[model samples]
Target: MCLLAFQLQKHPKYKLIMMANRDEAYNRPTTPADFWSDYPDILAGRDLEQMGTWLGINKQGKIAALTNHRDFSLPETGGQSRGHIVSSYLQSNETPEDFLEQLHNSKNEYSGFNVLVGSSEELYYYSNIEQKTEHLKNGTHGLSNAFMNTPWPKTEAVKKLLCDYAESTNEIDVDVLFNMMQRAERFPSEQLPDTGVGGELESMLSSIFIASKEYGTRCTTVLLVDSEDQVYFEERTFKNGVFATAQKFSFTIENPTA
Candidate 1:
């Protein structure tokens, strides 16, 4: 997940509301969300090349999502795929804090990443670069290539939109939320972050939706789990910046958070 805005335990009817866009290389092999035959409880899109996932929820009500830290100066290879962090956490018996502690101890084995995990009662945030696990507060929060809610222009803009959505009504409108992810505006050069990538490249990635010939926003996802434990997950995939298809799944969660 490249850009996301989520609210945990902030609404009266819904316990978790998350909308994220997964930006990946067009050449990377990927499959839409599903319940793995080997792990029926796990529901998420798969990174076929690496056998991992960017975001998912299980029958146990565990939820997780991952984003890569922006630092082009650092090499992007020779490390484990960060997507595994989400899948492993969702499948494990460990609590969110316990799993993050294990990850913190062996973080160097993976590349730079930001992971969000836990249950409806609480959500945890951890980034290898930040090297600290934080319990996310009960409010709408934004995430991108940097740390959680670091106030990137796009992050701030989308976060505010999410916060307003949560505050405006009890039922979420998936169309409106998904439309917010299609923004392609470039941040003013002065507002852009210098993450060692070239200025031109930075400009292209500055928007909420990233579009390029080689790499772009491959999928846009919206997930909502209500107080009744009903889950709604939808993923709209794209091919080289063009619309492809959407995968929709719904189920009742029975997994225990404790």
Candidate 2:
């Protein structure tokens, strides 16, 4: 997940609302989002190359998502698959705090990455690059390659859009969220971050929906949990930023025993 925007605990009729786009190489092999056969409770797309996932949820009402943090100094083969960090949380019964506290010791083994885990009711953010973890407040937030809500042009733009979505209605308009992902507006060169990558490359990656011949936006996903505790997950996959397919899954979050 290169770009992520979400509104939590701020909507009248929803517990959480989120929209994200995963950017990857056009040639990389990936499976569309689905309930894993081995871990049938887990729902997410598989990174075939690593047998992990960038984002996922389980029947236990657990949610987890991961985004790579750009760091040129790190070797391509960092200790572990960052995707596995997300997949691991989905399969475990640990609370986000406990899970991350354990990972703190070994986080250095992984490549630069930021991770979010816990149910919508109690989300937590941690980045190995920043070496910090904190409970996300109830409000709109964004994440990209740098850090949580670093005000990157794309992050700031979509955060406002997501904020509107959260405040707009009793339920989110999936279409509105989907269309926002199609934004291709490139940030001006001067406004882009210089994270070691050259200005030319940064500009190309500035858009919410990227379109490069070798690499681009791979999928757009919208996830929501309503006031009644219904969960909806949708994904639209693409090839070079062109829509290729879409998938949807729905469930209800079981209430805790009194």
Candidate 3:
């Protein structure tokens, strides 16, 4: 998930609310949000290339999402895919804080990325790039390719929407969040990081929404876990060569202990 905005609370009707965008090139192979056959309780869009996911939720009320770290100086070491970190966390039995602590000590196992994990009791964030992991205090937060709460254009856009959505006392629903995500705009190409690998040049040559591309949002995703522990996940894909598409899925805590 490239951009994520959320409201987390302890309320009974809606304990956790999340909206995010999973930006990637159009050609990346992925299975849209659905229940995995091997893990029926796991609901998320799978990255077919690696048995991983940008975001997912399990029937036990666990939630996880990951964002690639934006850095030009790091070497490509063919480390574990960041999506696997999210999927592994969602499939674990650890609490948010415990899971983050474990992840902090095991960062060397995976590529640099930012991860978000949560349950009904807590929410935590981990960034391998920064080598830090901690719980998020009660408040709204936004995260993109950079650090959490960094004011990038997409982050700010989603943050503003989240704040606006939170003010209205009306019952929040998944569709409302999906509409907001769909309407999100991409950042200008010039703002993209210059990887010095002719990324800027390639961006100019092709319209693919590559992270290395000049400026564009490859995907947008939103996740909401209501007070009832009902988790909702949605994503929109943008490809330079084809029409865009959107997908959404929802799952509630079954038995709250699954």
Q: Which digits, one per residue and each the tens of the lDDT, describe model 2 over residues 1-258?
A: 899898888888878888899999989899999999989989899999989998887766788899999867656545778888999888887778889998887887888889998887879999887788989998999998989989899999999988876676776789999999889989898888888788789899999889998999999999988777789999999987789999999998665210
2 versus 3: better TM-score goes to? 2
lDDT of 1: 0.90
Pairs in clash, predicted candidate 1: 59-255, 60-255
Best by lDDT: 1
Off by over 4 Å in 2: 73-77, 255-258
Model 1: per-residue Cα lDDT over 191-221, one tens digit each? 9889998899989999999899899999999
lDDT of 2: 0.87
Mark the regions of model 3 whose C-alpha exceeds 4 Å error after superposition: 10-12, 173-175, 183-219, 234-250
Show the colliding residue pairs in model 2.
none
lDDT of candidate 3? 0.70
Q: Say which candidate scores most in TM-score.
A: 1
Candidate 1 — which residues are off by over 4 angstroms? Answer: 73-78
Per-residue lDDT of model 3, residues 120-140, tens digit only:
557788888788877888777
Ranking by lDDT: 1, 2, 3
In what order do the candidates fall by TM-score, top score first? 1, 2, 3
Give candidates' CA RMSD values in order.
1.4, 1.8, 4.2
Each prediction's whole-model lDDT (CA): 0.90, 0.87, 0.70
